[model samples]
Target: MPPRSAPTARQRRLGAELRKLRDSVGLSSTEAALRLKITQSRLSAIEGGRYGVSAERVRAFARLYDCRDAALVDALAGMTAPRRRNWWEEYRELLPAGLLDLAELEHHARTIRTAQVTHLPGLLQTVDYARTIFRQTIPELPPPMVEYRTSHRIKRQQVFWAHPPKPYSATIHEAALRMRFGGRQITREQLAHIVTMSERDHVTVRVIPFEAGSFPGAGQTVLYAEGTVPQLDTVQLDTEHGSEQLHSNAQLDKYRTFLDRFEAIALTPSASRGFINQILKAL
Candidate 1:
């Protein structure tokens, strides 16, 4: 098959797992390709996410690598299955590629956790709030591009409306709750929506008040998407340029610790609800 010019995060992750398996087993590319009856170039293409891996190939790699985790192998095979075009594809030309990839990742997430220091989480932002945030972009954006991004962000919240909703945990700092984006009314509505969302059994919203005291990594926004297995988990960070994804075991571990620390200092769901109410009252 011809190689893809651009691969999604899911595709790259499958390829990374394949390479990880080979590395864990201490097999050189040439040696593994010879054992699997394939060329080194093809293996490299698959590992680099330039080639689409077939289900058969995924299993073959599992068998050759001496991996006996039936669940992990099945999960990998599922990734190899033909994928339908997601909603994000509709705006592929309008939004940044990283933003599109983020939408796709959120669509497939089983469990989502996030920590926000300033801006509200994208998945929970209201339309007006999102538009205001977009308008505030440094150097400013063209009206059309701002509209496109605002619409794209609003649509991303649909994950909460899935047939069987995925579990979502958000740790929002007190400062973000008081930002007043789009003025007091818009920010109030956004906070209300967050409160309503938290009432669901699958959703939890916690507040990290200024009174929480000191903590590490307080200046970052983190969205952790948990996959079927821990090995497939991903951590995404928003930057001035674009989205950055982290999947290496070390990177994942570090972010996991960040979430743990922040979550520890956050208010419980009930308290968080009351906290939002207090903020709304002040507004």
Candidate 2:
């Protein structure tokens, strides 16, 4: 099993609110459970943030505790609803915890902005492109493992088509456009695909030209996401060993600054599309 940690910020907040409610009503867990028509153990788990509470149950508990704070009750209800398991969970055995956490954050984000310097971002990669990249990794992954990882990446792309699809903005380096993933013919097809995808209303794709030289973001890739709640915005940095998630206010601020700087050095959407077409023709 993965090592356990303290509850997350959201979980802690929920637990504190529940504890306050119980105190206000002067009710013990057993008494509260009896009033709410649930077992004492269940109430204990909910208050401790070990188990998710149901919206209806949250309402019942709030009423029982004489919680007249309508806004707080609504917030609690939203927090307790069943969330879909992250798609990356299927790859739990193969991926590190940080990457899995980033995937979960991506699934829940309302907006995403990214910059890629050396390769196509996973969301934009074609199946052949993904396969080529995976097969080239050193230490030689087994064929089945490589296939599983590629399939997992494709599934991650489905988030773009989900109900109320999240908006995405990306700035890709020109070198990535020129790199031949699975050879020239496949690279041409991938470039053409990029042009088509960029035209979608929810996606913005820009190219940072080679001439945009030595910029603040010339070497690294970064992904920034805005969560459903304002406090959840996070930045993910991919490294050789693993990925890292940055959620501290200071780190998020720095990434936001980096994004603004990178955007300034990239081609406009229309120009980027024309640039991609030019590369496709040359290929």
Which structure among the candidates has the greatest TM-score? Answer: 1
lDDT, residue 279, candidate 2: 88
Off by over 4 Å in 2: 1-80, 83-86
- Local accuracy of candidate 1 as per-residue lDDT tens digits, 140-207: 99999999999999888899889898899999999999998888789889999999988999999999
lDDT of each: 0.90, 0.79
| Alpha-carbon TM-score of each model against the true structure | 0.97, 0.74
* Total residue pair clashes for candidate 1: 0
Which tens-of-lDDT digit does each residue in 1-283 have in candidate 2? Answer: 1212433334444655687789887999889889888888877767777667678878888899998888767766777655455567677778556656666667767899999888988888888898898898777789987898788778878878978878999899899999998999889878888888899888999998999887776467799988655445778888777677676668888889999998899999999999999989887
Model 1 reaches what TM-score against the true structure?
0.97
